[model samples]
Target: LFLGLIILIAVWKLSQTFTIMNLGKETSESLGISYSLLEKLALFLVALTTSVTMITVGALPFLGVIVPNLVRKRYGDNLSQTKLMVALVGANLVLACDILSRVLIRPYELSVSLLLGIIGSLVFILLLWRGGQKDAV
Candidate 1:
């Protein structure tokens, strides 16, 4: 828990840097951001967080992939603004799936990964469909 908090704080602090980095390497560098260093830092943080999460709660499958995309689709591409919403939505999704898995079969519980996988696949398909429609238009 403490480690997670530390990582969350680190990520929160760097959110603006990340936003600048998203503007492309040359642009961010022109704006006084070290693109390579920030990229390495971001990758390191992601690796550490993923390692910790896996050790703590097993694998969450597509929660990472889907939550941010969903949040971005609704809230645009600003990392600092969307970060909290992503965390909240991801937590709520896992909590809801876990609760449903436990209650859906009475005595027998489904694996949270299984539930997330099914839901994630559907959401991914929907996102793809929406992307295709936008491209077509």
Candidate 2:
């Protein structure tokens, strides 16, 4: 929990910088942000969070990818604004998948990772399809 809190605080502190970083390297540098330093910091934070999560909860395949994409699609591209929503959605998604995995087969449970992988692939395909459609028009 301490580690999680630290990661959360770090993300909160850096969220605005991340938002600026998304605007392209030259733009962010022009805006006085150290692009490389912030990028390294972001990468470190991601590694830390991933390590902590993997150690604590084992693998949660696709949770990281799907949750943020879903949240971003609904909330737009502001990391600061969407981070909390992404966390909440990810938690709820895991909880829901866990419940479904347990209930789907009586006296036997599916792997949560398996469920998430399948769902994530479908959602990813749908997202790509939608993106392609938008580009076509």
Candidate 3:
């Protein structure tokens, strides 16, 4: 199961890297890569990862939406850079939240997963709201 999880994560990260590099089906196809194949591969990888995460960590609810976007916002769309930044930020966020939860609760640490879900969701909502409300002109 651990090996499966690792494979799924690798595939998921690679798929995301490819997608970031290519941007869209038309662009990817023009560049001679099979977008359909890549899309299917990505979906499969994501599904596997999600299933493992759900079963192992319970409902995550927001890491998927939150961490990657946080990275993209900070680093823009460079694939390698985005992946590196996301991994770093995600790790830092998890570590910080875990510490906060431990210290605040005192011998009753909230699950890191739960903290991430709440924090990520709230942050994502605020970002979306701000983006939507910003003037387009």
Q: Which of the numbered candidates is closest to the native, going by highest TM-score?
A: 1
Q: What lDDT is obtained when candidate 1 is compared to the true structure?
A: 0.92
Q: 67-135, model 3: which lDDT tens digit per residue?
A: 887677767766655666676776788778778878878878788777877898889888788778872
lDDT leader: 1
Predicted candidate 3: what Cα RMSD to the true structure?
3.3
Weakest ten-residue segment in model 1 by summed lDDT: 128-137
In model 2, residue pairs whose N, Cα or C atoms come closer than 3 Å (at least 3 residues apart or on different chains), thus clashing, are none
Candidate 1 per-residue C-alpha lDDT over 12-33 given as tens digits, one digit per residue, 9 for 90 to 100: 9999999999999999999999
Query: Model 2 over residues 1-49: C-alpha lDDT tens digits?
Result: 6898899898999898999999999999999999999899999999999
TM-score of each: 0.94, 0.93, 0.79
Check candidate 3 and list the clashing pairs.
Answer: none
Task: Quote the positional error of residue 117 for candidate 1 in Å.
Answer: 0.8
